[model samples]
Target: MAMTVVTGSASGIGAATFSALAASGREVVGVDLRDAEILADLSTPEGRQAAVDTVLARSSGVLDGLVLCAGLGPQVSDAKRIVAVNYFGTVSLLDGLLPALRGGEAPAAVAVSSVSSTQITWADNPIAGLDESEVEAALEVGGDYRGQLAYAASKNALTVAVRQRAGDWGAAGVRLNTVAPGAVDTPLLQAGLDDPRYGEAIRSFVGPLGRRGRPEEIASLICYLLGPAAGFVHGAQFVIDGGVDAQFRPTAF
Candidate 1:
């Protein structure tokens, strides 16, 4: 059976993807802070390392699919935390698992970015290969008061980071890509909507489709990217945001 590892498998897109992959007959290992085959906090380096080590040992150091959906919303009250999980954690875990992916059958990985990634340009992201201390100082200097910019920066940086690694991964028979979703109606979205500071603004912004995305909808796209169907689809970013990105920057792309 094909072996896969999914992060944030506790809820939202992660949970949905986990279920979908299992239903597809993949031997899926879920990593989360709780209620998963591997429990560890992606927000912390130590937790991320533990999760990776466990997956490595369980899968016998060979992995076919990796989906990094663990993240924090902008309303988390801590800008650093957003950068920690959204960017640092994803990058760290990806690095730790790259060796296993190299040994799999037609391996592939998909990371969850955001339409918010489009809110900022690559030049403004400045977080592709930054350390925690550098991210903290940058966030402090950039005045990410509510961590909104940090959230955008982290997602944007993730997409770029994945793209940068595509060459090597593809050469090694492993594919890598990203999915950038807009406002999806998940637990994470609910948290943002409930935030006193960002709620009103989030409510005001709606996709052209006039409805938030469903977790299953995003999960479908993620699963496709991980399968043989996407064997040639490497280093790409699929935006499943209900046309939000096109509406915001139609001419940009």
Candidate 2:
């Protein structure tokens, strides 16, 4: 059976992915701050390291899949933490878990990014090449825009990192891809909907499909990428937004 590790397994897409993978008969290790097999705060250096160490130990230094779904929305008050968890925390694990991925059978990884990543301009987003500390310094200010910028920029940076590294990982017989979902009805989306800053805006903005995505829908895509069917797909960023991306910028993709 395949062994996989899912971050942010407590709820939302992460929880949904965990359940979906287990339902398919894969051995899955759940990692979250709570209600998971491995508990760790992915926002901090120590916490990310701990999550990595625990995953390697529990998986016996071999893993067939890794799904990174732990993230924060723009409603989060701290922009720095957004950068930390979304970019730095995620990339750290991508690098840290490479050895285990190499040791497994048909290893593949999928990360949850967002359609909003394309909305941010290059000039405003500094997370592409900056170190963790430098990115933290750049987003030190406190505000909704700051949080929004951090959220988008971090995901953009993460996408870039995965694409750039996909060739190397593929050479090692490990496939890597990312999923970008728009306005999914997850707890994170709920947070934005309930927040005073973005609630009305979120409720008002509808995609061409006129509905939000369900967590199972996104999880199904992730599971397919990890399975044997998508063996040829590599380093691709799939935007599954129910036509939102298409409606906004059909020619851009």
Q: lDDT values of the candidates?
A: 0.89, 0.89
Number of clashes found in candidate 2: 0
Compose the digit string of candidate 1's lDDT tens values, residues 101-174. Answer: 99888899999998888888887676656778778767775563548878988998988889899888888888
Backbone clash total for model 1 is 0
Q: Which residue runs of candidate 2 sit more than 4 Å off their true CA positions?
A: 122-124, 140-144
lDDT of 2 by residue, 153-228 (tens): 9888888888889889989999999999989898899999998888998896678889999999999999999999
Alpha-carbon runs more than 4 Å astray in model 1: 126-128, 141-144
Measured by TM-score, how close is model 2 to the native structure? Answer: 0.96
- Report the lDDT of model 2 for residue 175: 95
Pairs clashing in candidate 1? none
